[model samples]
Target: MRASVKRRTKTQQDVQPETADVAEDVSDRIRATLAKAISEGALKPGSKILEDAIADHFGVSRTVVRGALGILEHDHLLERKRNRGSFVAAPSIEQAKELFEARRTMERLILELALGRASDADCDRLNAIIDREDAIHHGTDEKAKAELSGEFHIELARISGNGVLTELLEKVVARLALVMTLYEHEHHDDCGTDHHRAILDAVREKDLKRALHLMDEHLADVEGRVRLTQDHGDRHTFEAMLASFSPQ
Candidate 1:
C-alpha cells in the first residue's frame, strides 16, 4: 500500500506542472485575442469584461480568464471595480491629454534616434509596413488593418534600435486605443496612413526638423478629436466582443 501511494503521488506531481503550463498558455491566448479586439475598436471602452463569457468562449476556467484580465488591468487596458467587475478602461479627458503629452515626448526622442540610426533598408521596412496595412480590404481584413493602425510608429521605434523605447511606446499606443474609442466622434479615423507616409517621407530625407514638426502635428490631430464627454455610441455586448476572437 505504501509503494502504491508513492507511485500515485509521483504521477500527480508530474501532471501538475503540465496542467499549469497549459492554463498559462491559454491565459496568454485569451489575453492577446482580447487585446487585439480592444485595439481594433471591436471591443468598445467602458464595456464590462464578463469573466464568465470569456471563460465560456475560450473553454477555460474563470481562473484562467482572470489571469488574462489581471495583465490587462496592469496595462490600464482594463479597470477593476470594487465588487462590480472589470471593464474596459475609459480614460477621462484630462487623462487623454496626459497620454498624448507623454506620446509626443517619447516620439520626438524616437524620431531623433531613428534619423540618426535608421538605414535605407529600415526605411524600406517602414514602407512595407505601411503598404501592407494599406492593402488590407476594408471589409475582408478590417480587423487586421485597424489593429495595425499604430504600427508604423512602432516600426520606426524598432529601427531606432532601442528595445526599451519600443516596448514603452507599444504600451502607450495600446492605452491610446482606449482613449480614441471612448472619446472620438463618429467617422473619425486618426491613424490614417497619410500622416504615416508624410512622417516617413521626412525621416527618409533625414529632415529631422520636418519630421519632428510633422509628428507633433500628427499627434496633435489625434488629440484634437477627443470631446470632453460623449455617449458611448458603439458599445457592444460581451458575447459580441468574443465572437470574432480567435486564439493567437
Candidate 2:
C-alpha cells in the first residue's frame, strides 16, 4: 500500500500541467520565430504582421500572437499603432544614429568585461562561432551571413557572462540589423572575416587595449560605409514622369 501511494504521487507530479507556463512557452516560440525572420531580412522592414494571419499560421489563438508581438514591440522589432495593425519597425535617421551610438558604447563595455572574465572555454566557443561563420560566408546566401554578423556582436556579450548585458546587447544588435536592412544600399557580408579574426586574436593574446582599438575601428569602418543619405522612397509614376523633364 505504501509503495503504491508513493508511485501514484510521483506519477501525478510528473503529469501535472502548468497552463500558464505552457502558454508562455508558446508565446516565446512565436516571438523567436518572428524575430529571426525579421533579422534574416525574410520579413522586410515596415512589413505588416497581421495577428489573425500569424495566429492561423502558427495554429495559436490571437491572444498568444498578441503576447508575442508585445515582446517584439518592446524589443523595437515591431511597432503597434493605435488604430493600425503592427508593422515591422523601420528605424528613422535619428533612431539609426542613436542605435549605433548605443551599440558602440555597450559593446565596448561588454568586451572590456569579457576581457576580464572570459575563460579558455569561453574563448573557444567564440572561435567556434567564427569558424561556423566562415563556412556560411562561402555559401551563396548573403542573408544567412547577414544574420550571423549581428549575432557575432551579441555573442561577445554572452561570453562576458553578464546576463543583463547580454540581453541589452541583443536588443541593440537587433535594432542595428533593422537599420542595416533599411538603409544599406547593397547587402555585403555583415562583418569582415579578417576584422573578426583579428579581434579574436587580440582577445586570445590578452591585449585588451588592442582588442578595444580594433573593435572601435571595425565599428567606425562599418558605420562609415553606410551612406545614411540613401533615399528609401518608393518608385512612383509621378517621379518617373517628372524625371523626363530633366535638362539632360
Candidate 3:
C-alpha cells in the first residue's frame, strides 16, 4: 500500500509541471487571440467586450479571460468605460495624427540606431523580412500585405538592438495597424519598399544621415495614405464593431 501511495505521489509530481504549462499556454493563447481580434478589426473601436462570450469561445474561465483583457487594456488595445464594460479603443483623427507623428519619430530613431549597430546577420534578417513583404505585396492577400508591412517595420526595430525602443515601436505599430484598417485610402503597391531598400543600402554603407532621411520620407509616405475624419458611420454598430474586432 505504501509503494502504491509513493507511485501516486510520483504521478502527481510529474503532472504538476504539465498543469503549469497548460495554464501558461492558455494565458498566451488568450493574449494572441485578443491581439489578432484587435489587429483584424474584429474588435472595432468602441465595441463592448463580453467576458463571458470570450470565455465561452476560448473554453476557458472568465478569470483567464479577464487577465487577457487586462493585458490588452494595458496595451491600449482595449479600454474600460465606467459601467459600459470594456470596448475596443477608438482613435480620433487628431489622436491618429499624434500616434503617427510619434511613430515617425520613433522609427527614425530606430533606423539611425540600426544603421550604427546592426550586424551582418541582422541586415540579412531585415532583407529576409523585405522579401516576405514583397511576396505578400505580389500575392492576392490584402490582409497579409498590411500585416507584413507592419512586421517589416517591427523587424527593423528589432534589428536596432534596443529592447526598450523595440517595445515602444511594437506599440506604435499596433496602433498603426488599427489606423490602416480605419483610414487607408488606396492600396499602394511596393509599400515604401524602395525607401526600405534605400535605408538598408545606406545602413550597409554606414551612412547614418542618409538612412535617417530615407526613414523620414518613408514615414511621410505612410502618413499621407491615411484619410482620417469624424465619419465612422459604418463602424458604429455593435455587430459591425464586433466584426471589426476579429481577423480580416
Top of the candidates by lDDT: 1
Per-prediction TM-score = 0.84, 0.83, 0.82
For model 3, residues 1-248, the per-residue Cα lDDT tens digits are 99999999999999999977776688789888778777866566666789888788878788888887888888888888888888877766777888998898888888888888888988888788787877777889866754564676788888888999999988877877667666776648678877777788888899988888888888889878877765642344444646656888
Which candidate tops TM-score? 1
The regions of model 3 sitting more than 4 angstroms off are 1-21, 232-248
Model 3 TM-score relative to the real fold: 0.82
Can you write out model 1's per-residue Cα lDDT over 1-248, one digit (the tens) per residue? 99999999999999999999999999999989988888887777777888998899988899899989999999889999999999888777678778888899999999999999989999999999877766763346656657675788998999888999998899899988878766665445335677888989998899999999999888887877766453442333333356556565
User: Per-residue alpha-carbon lDDT of model 2 for 157-224, expressed as tens digits?
Assistant: 88888899898888878777778766765556636667778888888888999999999998987777
Stronger candidate by lDDT (2 vs 3): 2
Clashes of 2: 0
**Range of the 10 consecutive residues with the lowest summed lDDT in candidate 3:** 232-241
- Screening candidate 3 with a backbone cut-off below 3 angstroms (N, C-alpha, C), the clashing residue pairs are 41-244, 41-245, 42-244, 42-245, 42-246, 43-244, 43-245, 43-246
Model 2 misplaced stretches (Cα beyond 4 Å)? 1-17, 233-248
